[model samples]
Target chain A: MAEIMSLSEAVTANVNDGDTVALEGFTHLIPFAAGHEIIRQGRKDLTLVRMTPDVVYDQLIGAGCARKLVFSWGGNPGVGSLHRFRDAVEHDWPSALEIEEHSHAGMAARYVAGASGLPFGVLRGYVGTDLPKHTDTIAAITCPFTGEQLTAVPALRPDVTVIHAQQADRHGNVGLWGIRGVQKEAVMSAQRSIVTVEEIVDELNPRVTVMLPSWVVTAVAEVPSGAHPSYAHGYYERDNAFYQAWEDISRERDSFDAWIDRHIRNTRDFSEHLALVREEGVVMA
Target chain B: MTATLDPPSTKATTDEIMTVVAARELKDGVVCFVGIGLPSTAANLARHMHAPNAVLIYESGTIGAKPTRPPLSIGDGELADTADCVVSVPEIFSYWLQAGRVDVGFLGAAQLDRYGNINTTVVGDYDHPKVRLPGAGGAPEIAASAKQTFLLLRQTPRAFVEQLDFRTSVGNAEGGSSRSSLGMTGAGPAVVITDIGVLRPDPQTGEFVLTALHPGRTVDEAVAATGWPLRVSDDLTVTGPPTAEEISALRALTGA
Candidate 1:
């Protein structure tokens, strides 16, 4: 019972202002197109969630779509620091951004607990660590079986979970291969979800059984080359140059604003945005 | 192909020396949970050298990643394509890591203490940090759960601090029964491979004791770099320079 729709329509209907949204993908299959749509629609006050908030999250944060970021790490991978994220914390240029941080293990456990319909997640974490001092979400709980103590984090039940996959059937059965992080748990843990796929086919022959049946998915949008800077498994290669170029673009506030305004805000859709990137001779390979 | 050229007498950088020291610690068939950057280089070098069967797990859920070239990040797509198997992130942490299946956890940190507790979270104040570092991703769990750990870091007074600004990963946790009291299963940091040399925790005190120094680096140099009053082993060894085979393999893998 999933409806295939346009990325814009999906974002408008599903993602809303002041909602907690998780765009989950490790590095591959990042829903950059859907994130751009959220920026284009001018959604604000959203608490964006991801294990690692790479370029897309930087764009969303830079565009002033996010009021808070609930994540583990926020950086431009391999290149350097996320300047916009740093600016938001230090200067609060667009707005004051609240941050709730956790380790990758803690975040994954929280999502698993949420998907499992549990009240809280338990793990051996935050011991001899200062994360508990900064964030209220992480707490220490005593083990009932033994007299041992462990870490407890609240379940992450987001308002909407947005993810990108390689392909999905017309019936909305999404299949993602390669490095799939916590997309399944993210989708299942959310109240509603939007999946942007590279293609919609009759059936899937995924290398592995990393598929989401139609029952759990809410909407499927066909956005080819959706994970532009990030790569889709089989569609294309990662644009490492853009990741390096982002360091320069995001360093200055004016350059960051100008880049986002031209590439994301000015373009109509992902295809148009991609065309602009290519037409400008930005080397993807 | 017939004529063999003599090994170059060119000197290696401190970084290369550190890399060689870290890579030599790995044994054949060890399961290593590798962090990005320096640890990745060491783990891959281990594979190309003696530990060919060592399983390299990235936090991105790629188990046994066999990248033909070096991966830029743990989440790089190239890691996935090259990996033996890819599972969900939850499974990677829960089943492989937290289950104590990982033999060696290789990590890097901004700051470290005598007890081996690492601080990758912040530099100064927690609330208003002088430098807000990339928060802990999986290092906490990896540090606590892996059977043992190997740390690669540059030796400096600021980095080898007396007290970490933040404890992103617990090593001995003030040493003694503290680690066991916290329900940590790992044996804590086994060895810290720095540019100056190798430091291993004393069995009784758990304070890192300098056991070896790299060529041209003296015990005084190591002690000067350490923030705490560093102790030296009575029978310390000046570690042998990188072997010809090790250097060749490392150069081939890293292409530097």
Candidate 2:
């Protein structure tokens, strides 16, 4: 019995300051917009964790909210910059930042181990290089069966897992159109979860049967233009103009906040930016 | 391993320096967690050149792989068929990566900052990011836990940057020794390879210092392309461009 709530309310309720949270999507796909609202809600001293965080991560960390941030690698050349992330390093921000050296699959695999409640998930990502000596969190352990060595990654359970999808029913049956990796595992590994969707449909709808059969979802929030800025594989066209603008803002560390304040923070409706894109249609070079 | 031995030069276009600079980091018997693209190409070269026995592990269960050519991603069959062993993702991490057994972790970056934090996230706001990247695959652990991480990239203001949009992976963040404080005793990033030259982390600051530049390149050019005030080693030297033989070997191996 999941109650439908506003995208913002659901996010504010589930996410708090400094809580270990996992957001759905790979780079740019189905990340919960409501999650961003949660960050904008002004929770501070949080430890943000992800495989590779992009603009959403940048905005949150830049806003001085993150206390300790952990992940693999990040970048966006010819358009955006990691100014706040770099400043946190060059000047050393109040937050403690840890850079785990592994691929996106490696991190997701760790989450899979976490969801399974295993002590540590064995992985095969970095075998020959120096990536192993960086930390003992994910260390190489001996295989009792094969007597061969392997890389063991510890399981991850976040405080909250926020996700967005194509559709969901009143009972919180999620329909993931096309998500990469084990996103479901990430949600299961969380203590609590929130989901946003485009439309509320009947559980017996044809779309549900073809795409997702809702059984493990908790709640659903409908956000029409939610994935507006981020194109949905085949749903809409990719926006390049917005990317260029973001590139400009991200490059200027000092002024980035002002830019975020003007565009991201200033707007009340998340759909406002969608209108800009619709009118301009993504400006491609 | 010996830089002085000049291999015969091969004639080709598309600027082979990026491939050559990346290939120079390989060492025999060393474990390398290789990401696809340029990093994979370089790791393969290491196997063919000096480190014929270098063990390569991909996310898709391949270990000690000697691929004929670089695959698009780790899932490519070349990694598994050519590998000496193929283990599950979790088993590999538990047995090799997390236990601190790997030697070199190779990676590619979309955005990087001064502290060595990387980003593979969006370019704008969270609710509405501009461009979404391909996301991280296994870079988090590879960047943090490897004995040392090597970043292969083309030198440019665009690639080398002041900061990242998101911290996708952690790499000696905060400072050089702070990783140790966080209970990380693994060797941090030892070197970063680019088209121009090679950069090493300073012992104390953990910030990257320019150690070598290409034959016709200048220190100013390297500095100009950096995202921050670039650091230089006390004994910097000009690196010789790849010889004709090295290029031929690289191309023939790549089948490009």
> Considering every candidate listed, which one attains the maximal lDDT?
1
Tens-place lDDT digits, model 1, residues A1-285? 778999999998999899999999898788999999999999999999999988898889988999999999877878878888878877786888999999999999999999999989988887878888889999889888996788899999999999999889988988988888999999999999999999998878656458889889999999999988888877898888989998999999999999999988899999999999998986673
Model 2, span A28-147: residue lDDT tens? 344636645765577777767665565667777777777766565454322434666765644554354544445555576778877788877775444433345544566767789986
By TM-score, the best candidate is: 1
Best by DockQ: 1
Interface RMSD of 2: 10.1
Clashing pairs in 1: none
lDDT (CA) per prediction: 0.89, 0.64
DockQ by candidate, in order:
0.73, 0.09
Score candidate 1 by lDDT.
Answer: 0.89
Clashes of 1: 0
- Residues B14-43 of candidate 2 have per-residue lDDT tens digits of 347767777776778888888767788888
